[model samples]
Target: MTRFSFNQATANRWPIPDLVAGCVAAGVTRVGLWREQVADFGLEKTAALVKDAGLEVTSLCRGGFFQTPTWYEENSRAIAEAHTLGAPVLVLVSGGLPPGSRDVDAARRHVGEAIGRLVPATVEAGVQLAIEPLHPMFASDRCVVSTLGQALDLAAPYPAEAVGVVVDTYHVWWDDTVWAQIGRAGRERRIACFQAADWITPLPEGVLLGRGLPGAGCVELRRFREAVDAAGYTGPVEVEVFHADLWARPGAEILADTIAAYEAHVA
Candidate 1:
C-alpha cells in the first residue's frame, strides 16, 4: 500500500480536480498523469492543483511517437510539461512503423536516434525518459518496441539517469526473456518506471483499451512486483488499467476498486 501509485488513465473520465480530491480522500499520495488530460485541464492549473493537494505526480505519459513529423517539437513540449508538473520521469511509447513501411528494424533504429536527440533536453530538465514497450498486438500502429529487452537496448546508449526503461507487467509478462531483462535493467540501473495491469482474455475489438485491473485476469501481478523489488527498484508501483467498461464507472468507485484490487493482488 505504501508503494502504490494510482495512474490517472485507470479512470479516464475522471476530472483532474476530482481525481486529486478523491486520491487525497483515499490517502493515495502518488499518481501517474497523461498529457491529454493535463492539457485539457490547463497545464499550469493542473500542476498547481496537484501540488496544492499534496499529491506527487509519478510520471507523465508520454513523450515518444518518434514517427510523427513534429516529434521533436512535441516531445520538447512534453518534457517541459513534465518539468512543470514536478514529475521525475516522462514515459515514452515509441511510435510504430511509418505509413506503408514494413521495415520494423528501420522504425526501431529511428526510435533510438530520436531518443538520443531528446537526451540533452531530458538531462537539462532533470527528468528521466522512460521507454515503454507495448504489447506486440500494438506493434503496427501504437508502439513497435514490444519487449523490455528491446527498450533497454534503445536506452543503452544514453546515460541511465537521462534515459531508462518501463517495466509494465501487462506488456512484458508473456515474454520468457523478461525476467532476465528485468534483472539486466536493474544491474544497468535503467528501470525508470514500473506499471501494473492484468492481461484479460478475448481482448476487445480495439484492444488498446482492453487492459484489466490488478487481480482481474491471469497475470502474475505479485511475482512481477517481487521481481522488480529484487532488482532493487524501490519506486512506486503504478496501477494503469485501460478498459472501457471500467471507465464507465464513477471516478471514486473506480479508485476504490483499484485500491482494493492493488491490495489483494499487487501490494
Candidate 2:
C-alpha cells in the first residue's frame, strides 16, 4: 500500500479536491496526474492542494507528441508544470508518424531527436523525461515507440537522470522480450515510471480506453510486480486504467475497487 499510487485517469471524472480528500481518507499518499486535468483545475491550485494534503505527485502525464509542430513549446510547458507540481518525472507519449508518412523508422528517429532537444530543459527543472511506448496498435496515430526496448533505445543518448522509460504492463505484456528488457532497464537505470493496467478482452472500438483494473483481466499482475522489484525498481506502482465503465462509477467506489484490486493482484 505504501508503494501504490492512483493515477487520475483511473477515475477521470473525480474533481481534484475530492480526489485528494478521498486519497487521504483512504491512506493513499501518491497520485499520477494528467496535464488536461491540472490545466482545468489550475496548476498552482492543484499544486497547493496536493501539498497541503501531504500527497506526492508521482509523475505528470505527459510531455511528448513529437509529430506536432508545437512539440518543443508544448513539452517545455509540460516540464515546467511537472516541476511546479513537484513531480519528478514527465511521462512522454511519443506521437506517431506524420500524415501520409509510413516510414516508422524515421518517425522513431524524430522522437529521439525531440527528446534530445528537451533534455537540457528537463535537467534544469529537475524533471526526468520518461518515454512511454504505447502498444503497437497505436503506432499509426498515437506513439511509434511501441516496445520498452525502443523507448530505452531512444533514452540511451541522454543521462539516465535526464531521460528514462516507462514500463506499463498493458503496453508491454504482449512482448515476450519484455522481461529481458525490464532487466535491462534496471541495469541501465532507465525506468522512470512503472504503470499497471490489465489488457481486457473484446477491446472496445475505442481501444485507447480499453483497460481493466488489476484483477479484472488475465494479465499476470503479480509477476510484473515481482519482475520490477527484482530489477531494483523501488518506486511507486501507479494504477492507470482507462476504461469507460470504470470511469462512470462514483469516484470513491472506483478508488476502493482500485485499491482492492491492487492489493489482491498486484501487491
Measured with C-alpha atoms, the lDDT of residue 192 in candidate 1 is 92
Off by over 4 Å in 1: none
lDDT of 2 by residue, 172-224 (tens): 99999999999999999998999999999989989998899997787898999
In terms of lDDT, the poorest run of 10 residues in model 1 is 201-210
User: Candidate 2: minimum summed lDDT over ten consecutive residues — where?
Assistant: 213-222
Clashes of each: 0, 0
- What's the TM for model 1? 0.99
lDDT of each: 0.95, 0.95
Estimate the lDDT of model 1. 0.95
Candidate 2 residue runs with Cα over 4 Å from true position: none
Per-residue CA lDDT of model 1 for 112-195, tens digit only, reads: 999999999999999999999998988998899999999999999999999999999999999999999999999999999999
